[model samples]
Target: MNGSAGAIEGCYWQADRETREVSPALSGDIKVDVAVIGGGFTGLAAAYHLKVADPGLEIAILEAETAGFGASGRNAGFVMTLFGASVSMMKALHGKERVRQAHQYMVSAISALEAMIGEHAIDCDYERTGFLKIATAPAYISLIQDEIELFQSLGIEGFEWLDRDQLAARIRSPVFLGASWEPGCGLLNPVKWLNALRRLACANGARLFEGTRVSEVQRENGRYRLTCDH
Candidate 1:
């Protein structure tokens, strides 16, 4: 996994990050059923889920630096029920039904994240206060309406159009024309969240290596040999 030149550093999220006992660097060669090449949100989440499903599975997560030393630790912690782009844009690309399914999946993901937090007792200050997608331009009203209609077609309900007056009642914004509010979204402390997940992964038999960089993974006899720097 020659993905980077060296270990990445923690950005602004370090202020919110909780200190913990650190894992040692990779020194000698080792083998496992699975070797995750990164220690960010993606890698740790994969390890945690895999171990949960199959407790006996041997897994290891390798990080160039400490876990959450990349974008995963540095991101704004909004667990939004959004599909990256707006519902209208998604409907235009993949049509109504497909976009609806995609949107529904994101909604489900919000709850799943909540459940996972409680399940592991990961206290990252999670809040299900929901999300608001607002439109400042008058022309954007039609697009916001399209979002509501798209969800209605999916037999799903929870989205509502909030006029400027209604929006201001919640958040006082000067340029807001209208907005779409969904109640299933959330926010959290990203660094704390990742660390909790990492702890769970470790407790579930997923070995973690910090300050260890894997430069390549070579396949030999159907087994992977990870080249590393301790």
Candidate 2:
């Protein structure tokens, strides 16, 4: 890639023509019932949800950079339900029912994203092509099978285990022992989705700041105070 290669790389949450602009910096001191630190998905999601739950609630978000500058925007946008934590690990940590609920939560987050896309009419190239996790070795086959069984026991369905022949038809990787395809997973442009969300949130009365960094967070007199570095 050339140093001066292209126009600014696209971001999922940069203010767009149709979207109202979020303030890029915080000015003088302000007071709010709740002050959230960090501007990524969790912070923004919390702020948005808080306001949605009760619009009269006072909420503020302190972001260190443009909202999507963190892991939320830099990610490849594969929202996975069966990607990270293993079933055994979760069951050990939170028991089977809680783990299952946790898995459902992750899946629900994806569903929420889809719902937001529809409600806001965000044109972020979102799709539900489904995500495939392929096992690259024979030794890993059992692990894949185990996950399938766990999903089944939880009353989750539509996860298919593809054998070598079936895998070869879609992916040319020769070393893949098999693949597991989950029907409800897929990818999207993270930047587009985020920007659209930022816009929608702002329209619905959420204040977002870009190019601002938070230096410290403190609780004072039963309220959270966020100090920004400007």
Candidate 3:
């Protein structure tokens, strides 16, 4: 596995993390029931869940570099319930019902993440600090108010409008006009969470390979063969 410092140098999350052992690269041909490309959050979670569902299943995660060395570790790390750009935008694009369902799905996803962190006792510096959508100009105040009304029409709770004074109390900024506050929001360290997922997936019998790039994939007979540059 490529645990080299250069792989994690640019990302703040990965750079801040403590050094750990990296898994070895794939050596020679190997066979598995499932081959998951990329060792990011999605791949690791899929491997872990698949093993949980069926312990006998064989799974291997292939990564070009070390895990969490991509955007998975460099994101803003906001565990928010917002879907897409805005509620108004989503409703206009997918209609009211679909937007409501999407919002609900995001809410459920945040809940599931919290549950997983608690269940596994993952230390990721998680904080339920909530979210604030601030309006820096007078024109944006109406836009934010319209979004709040849209949320209300969709029967969504927990979102409220904070006037200039109220917002000032929370954050002392003169440029801010007003803001929308939602209680169902959180922040965490992305790289730490990724590392925890990697550990859990490995413990659940998922094999991970680093510095192993897949060059080609083809079907031979009834099985799929992956060509890699180790």
For this target, which candidate reaches the highest lDDT against the unseen true structure? 3
Which parts of model 3 are misplaced by more than 4 Å? 1-7, 219-223
For model 2, residues 16-132, the per-residue Cα lDDT tens digits are 424334455677777777677766777777777788888887776776656666787677778678634687777777777787777788789889989988887888888897877
Cα deviation of 34, candidate 1, in Å: 0.7
Deviating ranges (above 4 Å) for candidate 2: 1-22
Instruction: Write model 3 residue lDDT over 1-230, tens digit each, in one string.
Output: 33544247667776655677778889888889999999999999999999999999999999888888778878999999876887878888899999888889989999999999999999999999999999999999999999899999998888899999999999988899999999899999998899999999999999999888889989999888999896
Q: How high is the CA lDDT of each candidate model?
A: 0.82, 0.71, 0.89
TM-score of 2: 0.83
Cand. 3 TM to true fold: 0.93
TM-score of each: 0.87, 0.83, 0.93
Could you tell me which 10 consecutive residues in candidate 2 have the lowest summed lDDT? Answer: 1-10
Better of 2 and 3 by TM-score: 3
What is the alpha-carbon lDDT of model 3 when measured against the actual structure?
0.89
RMSD of each: 3.8, 4.4, 1.8
Q: What is the C-alpha lDDT profile of model 1 across 1-230, one tens digit per residue?
A: 22332223445656544456668878887878889998998999999999989998999899887888787878889998766576667777888778767777887888788888887788888988788888989878888888687778767688999999999999997999889998778889888888888888998999998888899878899888999985
Q: What is the lDDT of residue 225 in candidate 2?
A: 68
Candidate structures ordered by TM-score, highest first: 3, 1, 2
Clashing pairs in 2: 11-191, 12-191, 12-192, 12-194, 12-195, 13-194, 13-195
Identify the superior model by TM-score, candidate 1 or candidate 2. 1
